[model samples]
Target: MSQDLQYWKQLKEKNDASAIKYFYDQYIKLLYKYGYHFCQDATLVEDCVQDLFLRLWEKRSSLGDTDNVKLYLMVSLKRSIYEKLKKNSKTTVTEEVPEDTFDVTFTMEEQIISSETDQITKDKLLECLETLSGRQKEVIYLRFYNGFTPEEVSEIMQISNQSVRNVQASALKKMRNNMDDPLLILVVGKLIESFFHEI
Candidate 1:
């Protein structure tokens, strides 16, 4: 097994602070940023992230082992956020349209060093992203930006594999229609470049 898997094994077996801390150091920012995409509140996202880790540690003895820590944590954190939002009536925007959860915006750090072409590309990218439905944007971010598999994306989004495929197809189709460059070459390539750097 890999080092991460080893650590996860230790965590599941030991249920210790150090083991939890290791995961916290690695995943807190990712969970926070991801939760922020849905909630648009930094403090709330932070709380949800902290709570997710706390809950993980508290239930470590009961939790199953996992090789895919990122996908697991993303799935858990998303579920935790929705549960919290539902409990707090003020946080729940609507019961009927809970899947309309994304409001992702590019961060300053995510911005490319400015130039005429870069700015134009950024504008085009943001415009195309805006045209995507909230659920579609979430799927794109989870798939291309975070590098999750289609099955993992379905798990995180609580949708079927077929639904995941359909969503990806539709999102890429929209991007291809709006974009000057090929969807994967320009879109996923640029996202991959900046995404892994920060995460």
Candidate 2:
């Protein structure tokens, strides 16, 4: 077993505070980023993340084993955020969160994009990204940015495996058709390399 899995098992079986803290220390930043995508409220996102860990610790005795702790955490966090949103909506003071809130805004580091392309190409890439639907953007983010497999994304998004593949395919095709330059396509593929930075 990998070290992460071992730590997770320790956390589950022995209620190891150090093991749980190790996970929190490693993933809190990424979790915050992912949670922020679901709800732009930074404070709300932070609360949900803390609540997730607290609930995990309380329920650790009955938790199942997992080979992919990061994926599991992300799936749990997404659900937690949505549940919180739903609860908030039921209250008197209403807040509107659009169904398609998986917005993707690109922030290219000078070293990453400038060395290869000028401003025009960068602009074209951003335009191409804008063409994708929120679902498509979410699929792309989960697939490339987070390096999740299609099956994994299906689990995270609560969609069918084929739907994940279809959305990903259509999103890529849309971007390819929108952009004339091949370099833009290359950049899109390299989105895993901090192209989708923490919000």
lDDT of each: 0.73, 0.78
For model 2, residues 116-184, the per-residue Cα lDDT tens digits are: 666777777677777889999898777656778788888988889888878877876787777666776
lDDT of 2 at 15: 87
Instruction: Please give, for residues 1-199, the per-residue lDDT of candidate 1 as tens digits.
Output: 2766777877788766787888888888888888887786667778888888888888887888787888889888888777777776555455633788786764323333234446556667667778898888887677656777778888989899888878777776676677666653475445534433322
Off by over 4 Å in 1: 90-97, 107-119, 179-199
**TM-score of candidate 2 on Cα atoms, chains taken together:** 0.81
lDDT score of model 2?
0.78
- Among these predictions, the greatest lDDT belongs to 2
Model 2 residue 4 lDDT score? 85
How close is each model in CA RMSD to the real structure?
A: 5.5, 5.3
As for model 1, its CA RMSD to the true structure in angstroms is 5.5
lDDT of 1 at 75: 88
